[model samples]
Target: MDLFLSAAFGFPTVLFTPMLIVVLGYWIFVIVGAADTEMLDSVDTGGDAAGLSAVLSKAGLGRVPVTVALTMLICVAWFVSMMGSIVTSLIETVSTPMLWALGAVVLLIALVAAWAVTSGVVMGFQRFLPKRRGDSKHELVGRTCLIRIGEAHEDFGQAEITTAGGAAISIPVRTTGGEVLSVGSTALIFDHDAADDHFLVTAFDPALDPGQH
Candidate 1:
């Protein structure tokens, strides 16, 4: 127990200990709904996080959420560093300077190993994760949807549409010419506003549907 504690709190392992603690705390907050998994996703576009994002992208770890990638990285690095520290601690008659040098090498190796392992793990799991893409957005342009919100106006609205795959999803909607669509009302999605990422909708009349004729 004493040796484990000494190795954990010692150099190299010490560098990743704080990061591991932070990752654990953040996950606890996420489990309690106090934080979101995507909270750090937008941080990759700008600020200091951009540099980190670039590095992860280069490492093929960009497909996963920043928090997830970071958590895996810190966890793997901490474990590797802890093991390295324990191994080095077992070495007797090593001068203080030599131990420090060995710790530095361990830190570097830990980082590389973490990246390699995390990248493989991410690739293996990424296929099972839901993909965020607009490939099907165009298919919804001419579909009819039921208004899910109380009212859909020119500025704001939401409606539920079923895809060809039988999956239902809620999408932002808008009306033109001061059209008002209320809940339980059916609306036709005639166009998609790419700039605002919303669908243009108007009230639907079942009798007017060409498919019925």
Candidate 2:
């Protein structure tokens, strides 16, 4: 047990100890229902969450939450730390500065590798995971939505909708006619755009659209 502790707290592996601890503690919090509300709301298409997700969405990780992304990073760091320790252990003797330098380089490489692996997993999840309850995307067509971003264009935009569970969800949206939709605008999701993979929205007025009710 002492040997195991020494190895874990030793040079290279020690670098990732902090991250591993965080990951474990985070899960514990989630299990006990003490998870952060901020994380749950990150998947929202509006507000600052959208900006952060825009970069991740470009990287194919938009579906993944920030907490999950962070967890991935920590998991990869722990794995890399263990690998580094093994490699360094094979060496006879090394100077303190050299070890630190090696750890720094490993940190850079680990971060890149972690991002790749995390994004890959997130992409995979999008293909198989349940997106909206048990309903398929096709079933969501014709639903009404509220624009949640500054302006929703054919190119970029987001909207909020209420689910059968009475939970509000934010999702990507686009105009069917390439029109611009301002924040808080009401729209009817007429169809799904296959090319862009988002809902095609049309201007809707509760007073004018009889189908709104």
For model 2, the superposed segments whose C-alpha errors exceed 4 Å read: 1-7, 10-15, 36-59, 130-213
Across residues 50-125, which tens digit of lDDT does each residue of candidate 1 receive?
A: 4445567667887776788999999999999999999999888559899999899999999999998999998999
- The clash count for each model shown is 0, 0
Which run of 10 residues does model 1 get worst, by summed lDDT? Answer: 42-51
| Candidate 2: tens digits of C-alpha lDDT, residues 5-122 | 6546876567778778977998899889988523532323222334444566566665656566667767886777666665665566668887777767766776677788887787
Best by TM-score: 1
TM-score of 1: 0.60
Error of 1 at 167 (Å): 26
